[model samples]
Target chain A: MTSDILAEAMDYIDDDLISQAYSYSRGRPKFSKPLAVAALVAVVVVAAVAAIKYSDAFITAPDSGDSSTTAEYFGGFMPDKISDGELEYEGTPFTEKEISTFVEKNKYDLIGAIAAEYGDFESVYKISTSGYSHVNLGETNTLKYDYVDLPVCRDDEIIAKITLFRSDGGLSYTISVRGKAFDKYNSIYQGNLSAELAFFYYGFEELIITPTNHIYRVHGTEETLEIDRSMNYYEKYATEYNTFSYNELTDEKKYITVKPLPEEQINDGSAYTSSDIEEETAEAPETSTVRTVNIYVEDLMSEEIASVEWGSGYDLMLDRPFRVCTEAQKSEMLRFIENMKPTEAAEPVQYYGGGYIVRLVYADGTRASVVLMGGDQVYFETSEGESPIYVDTNGNASALAEYIVSLI
Target chain B: MDDTSIIKLYWERDENAVRETAAKYGKLCIKLSENILNNKSDAEECVNDSYLTVWNRIPDERPDYFSAFLCRIVKNLSLKRLEHNTAQKRNPEMLVSLDELQECLPSDNLPEKSFDARLLGKSISDFLRKQKEVDRCIFIRRYWYSDSVKAIAEDLGVKEDRISVTLFRMRKKLKIHLEKEGFCL
Candidate 1:
C-alpha cells in the first residue's frame, strides 16, 4: 500500500519525537539532599575562585598620566646609543702576563673547584703559545660521569674539548686536549679548584671569569679595554630583552635600537667574523653516519597497514622529491630508540582478536615487530632469532607500541 | 542482571547497584560516548562518570525504565565531555546530526522565543508512532544514537543512498507535522 495520501496527510517521527519518547519512558530522577549539597558547594567554590582571579579587571584602571615611575624603572637598563656591528668573539679578556699572575694566585682554589665540580681531576696538562698558555685537565674516567661536549678554541683551532656539567650548586667545566696534545705543555699545575676560576661565556666571543664583582672582556689582538657598565647589563638581560620593540614599551627615543650590520660587511673578506663563524658552526652534521630505519604500522581491526622509510637520501612520508628526514626528526627517532626496552618471552602467545602491529627495521637490516592484542597482550618478534617479547600487563611494550603507532 | 533487579538493588541502597547496571549497559554507554568523542579513553571515562551520576540520583528517584534513564544520563554526560574536549573544534558526528535537523528546527535568531523541549518531543513522538516501523527505526537510530548513515544502512540491510533518501522524506513529513502542530521555526 503506497502512502501518497498519508504522505500528503503528513506526520513522521523526528529527533525531538524520539528524544521525547525516550525521556517520557524514563521518569526524571532527583538528586539526594547530600549529593545536591555537595554539588552546590563545588559550584560555589569554583565561582569564588574565578571571581577573585578576575576581580582586578573590574577595578578602576591605573592613572595613565603617571609617567615618572615608568621612566625611572626603565632608566637604569636603557642604552644611550646602539651601534650596528657584528659581534666578534675576541677570546679571553686577560693578557698573558695577567693570566699567569691570576693563575699563580688562585691556582689552589681553582683546582679545588674543578675537583668538587667533576669529582676530581686526575691530571693537568698545559700548552704554551706566544701570548697565552692553553691548560688541559683530564678526567680519571670521562665515561664515568655525564658531560655535554662544548667546543673550545685553542691557537685559532677548535681542538680543545670542554666538558660542561651542571649540578644543583652551579656549573663546573673540565677543559682538556682532544687527543695526544698533552705533552706540548712546559709544566703541569694541579691543585684544589674553587668557584671563582669557573669560566662561562658571555656571548660566543667573550669569556667571562667571575673572581668577584669584576668582569674582564677580551678581544683578539686589539686590546682597547674599557670597564663598560653596559656590558654587565648585556650579560644579565640581553637574552631576555634583546627583541624589545620600542612601541611595546616607552617611546622610541627612550630605548637604544641595535639594528643588523649591512650585508656588505657580512660578505666582505673579514677574518673570524660573526657571520662566517655562525655559518660554519650552524651547518648540519655529516649525513654519512646516519642510520637507515623503517617503521611499519598496521591496524589489525581494519586489516590496514602503512609504512614509512627514513634515512640518508630516502624519505617516503614527505611530499617533496628526494628529501630525507630532517635533523629534528632524526633526533626524535634516536631518542625513541634509546628509551625503547621490550620484555623477553619464551614463545609467541596466540590471540585471535584484533589489535595493532608495529614493525621496526634498523640500519643493519635487523627487524623487530610488536603485536598488541586486546587486554594488553603485546607480543614482540625480532629477526635476530631472539626470544619473543611478551608483556602481559600494560607496561613498556604497550607504551612503546603506542609510540611507534603514533610515529607512522 | 535484569533492569528491574538493578533498580531494586539501587532502591535497597546497595553498592552492587552500580556493578549490576554496568554489567548490563556499559558497552552501550561506551558506544554512545564513542559515537560523539571518537576516543576510547574519553568514552570509558564518560561511562564511568555516568554510572556515578546514576548512583547519586537513584536514592531519591526510582525510574520506570532504567535503560532509558541510563541512556539519557550517559548521552548528556557524553555531550558534556564532547563540549569540553572540542571547545576549539566541532565534533564531526555531532555537527552532522545537528546540521541535518537544522532544516526543521528554528533558526538561532529567534533566541527570545523559547520553546518547551518536552512538548516538542511529545509532538514528534506522536508523528513517529504514526509512521511505518522501518522508517521509525531508521530515524531513531540516526538521530537518537547519532549513528552514521552507513551504520544505519548496514543495520537495516539497505544501501546508504536508500537510508539517506528515506531520512529526507521523513524530514519533509516532520516539517509538515510541525506546521500542522502550529510550531514555527
Candidate 2:
C-alpha cells in the first residue's frame, strides 16, 4: 500500500495525530477568484507566446544536409503553406483538424506543451507518449509501450529528445533539453501526463525543470529565484525571508517588505526585538548568582534577515522555541565555553556575511561580550583580547560564538 | 482552554471557539505541516486552511478528542499540498518513510486482493492496541504525522539511536501481526 493509503487508514484511530494536524484554527480565508483568473490568463499568454516563438525556429526546416527528413516531418505535421521553411507566428494557427491529424499520423498521445527561454533565444517543446493505454488496476494485464528515444532537430543539431516508458502504474515522460554550452543541457521528468512543466533559470548559471505550480522571476546572479508577487501567501513569505538585492550590481527596488509583527504576536519568544532585550535585561535579578548566557547570530549580508538567539532557557531564533537544552546540549555548551581561548591580535580577513555575538552575565553583575567574524578564516574577539583560531573539519570553534551555532 | 470547553463554544455557535483553538493548537498544526511540506510558508497556509476546516466541521461534529480531529484535518491538507507540489518528483523524506514500510506491506502487484480501507484501519488499530503505549505513539508519529526520527526522539526526551531501535523492532512486530491476521506478506 502507498504511504498515503496507510496515513489515511491511521487517521481513523489516532487522536493525537488528528489534533496535531488541526492545531491551527484561523478558519479558511477566501481567495480572490478574479485575481487568480487574471494570473492564470497571464501565465497562459506568456507560455503561448514563448512556445510559438521558439517552436517556429525548430519546426521550419531550412535547405541543408539531411533536409528531406526534416521536410517530411514538417510536411506531415504542418499545413502546406507553412512547410516552405518560413517561421512566423503571424501565420495561420493550427486548426483542430490539423492537430488531430498530426496526432493520429504520429501514433502518439499529445500530453502537454512547455516553453523555455535562454538568453536571447526561446525553445518550445511538446510532450507525447507512444504505445500508452488505459488499463484497470484490479485485473491482471500486460503492460504496453516499447521504450523509444525520439530526437527533435534544429538546423541539423539535435536540440531536444523525448524518452517514454511506463512505471508506477502510469506513463512517464523524460524530456531532455540539449545545447552546446556549459550548464545548458537539462532533463525534466513528468510521472503523470497532465502535470504542468516548469523551467527555472538559476542566476544565468543553470536551468532547472520541474513540475511545479509556483511561479518564479529571475534575479540576475542570485541563486534563488524570486517568487512572483501575485501568487499565494507562501510565495510572498519566501520572497520576504530568503531573497536579498546587491545595491552595487543593480539599483535597489525593494520587492519584499516585511511589516513588523504586533506586540502580542512578537512575545512568542522565537524572536526578540532590541527593545524586548533591553526590557528583559532591566528586569534581571540584581543579586542572584545565576549566569545568563545570550547568543545572537546574524547573516551579515542581509540585516533584515531574522537573527537567531539563544538565552534564558529558550532558543528564540528557531521556528519553534526550544524550551530547554538537553543534558547533552548543555554539556556541549559548557565544553565549548571552556575551550575558548583569548586571541593575541585581531587578523585582517574578508567577511562575506555571517557572524555571532555572545553576551555573558557574571554573578557579580558584570557583563562581557564576544564577537566572532565568519568566513574562511574565523576571528574571535573578546573584551580583553582577539585571535585567529583554526576551525577543524568537525567545525569545532575556539570561541563560544561558533560553538553556539553548531549546537543550533 | 480545555477541549470540552472548545466543543461547548462550537455548540453554542460562539466565534471565540476559533480564536481559542488557534491560541492553543496553532503551533502544533504548523509543525505538522512543516514536517510534511518542509517550507515555512506552505506550512503556515496548510495550518490556516486546517483551522478553517475545523471551523466548518466542528458545529456538526463535536469530536470526543478535539486534538485528534484537528490534527487529522491538518495532516490530510498538508499531504494534499505535498502531492500537488511533488507531482513530478516524490518528496525525498516521504519516499524514505514509504520505502521503509515497503518490506512489511503487501506488494502493489497483488491486484486481485482489494482490501477495504476501514477494515485495514481497524486491523491496524487492533495491532496498536496490543503494543506498548510509547511504541504505538512513536509509530503513529512517524508513519501518520510523517515526523522525522530526530523529532520523535527529541519530543520523547530519548536518544535518537534508542528511538531508531524501537521503531525497527515495532515494524517487525507489525509485520508478524499482519501476517497472523491472514494478509499475505
Local distance difference test scores for all models: 0.39, 0.40
Q: Which ten residues in a row have the lowest lDDT in candidate 1 chain B?
A: B153-162
Candidate 2: list runs displaced more than 4 Å: A14-408, B87-91
Maximum-DockQ candidate? 2
Q: Can you write out model 2's per-residue Cα lDDT over A331-387, one digit (the tens) per residue?
A: 433544454433333532222223344443332334323344431123223332332
Reference contacts preserved by each model: 0.06, 0.27
> In the order shown, what is each candidate's alpha-carbon RMSD?
27.0, 27.2
Deviation (Å) of A38 in candidate 2 = 65
Sum up the clashes in candidate 2. 16
Off by over 4 Å in 1: A1-408, B88-90, B107-114
lDDT of 1 by residue, A1-408 (tens): 012112111223243444443332222111111333333323322232222121211110111111221111111111223332322221233333433443333333333222222232343412211122111111110111212223222222333333333223223223332222222110111111222222222211122333332433322211322223443333332221111111211232221121223323322423123332234334423322222222221211111111112211111111011111122333444554544433343332332323355444434433455455422334334432222222211122233344445544
Residue A58, candidate 2: alpha-carbon lDDT: 18
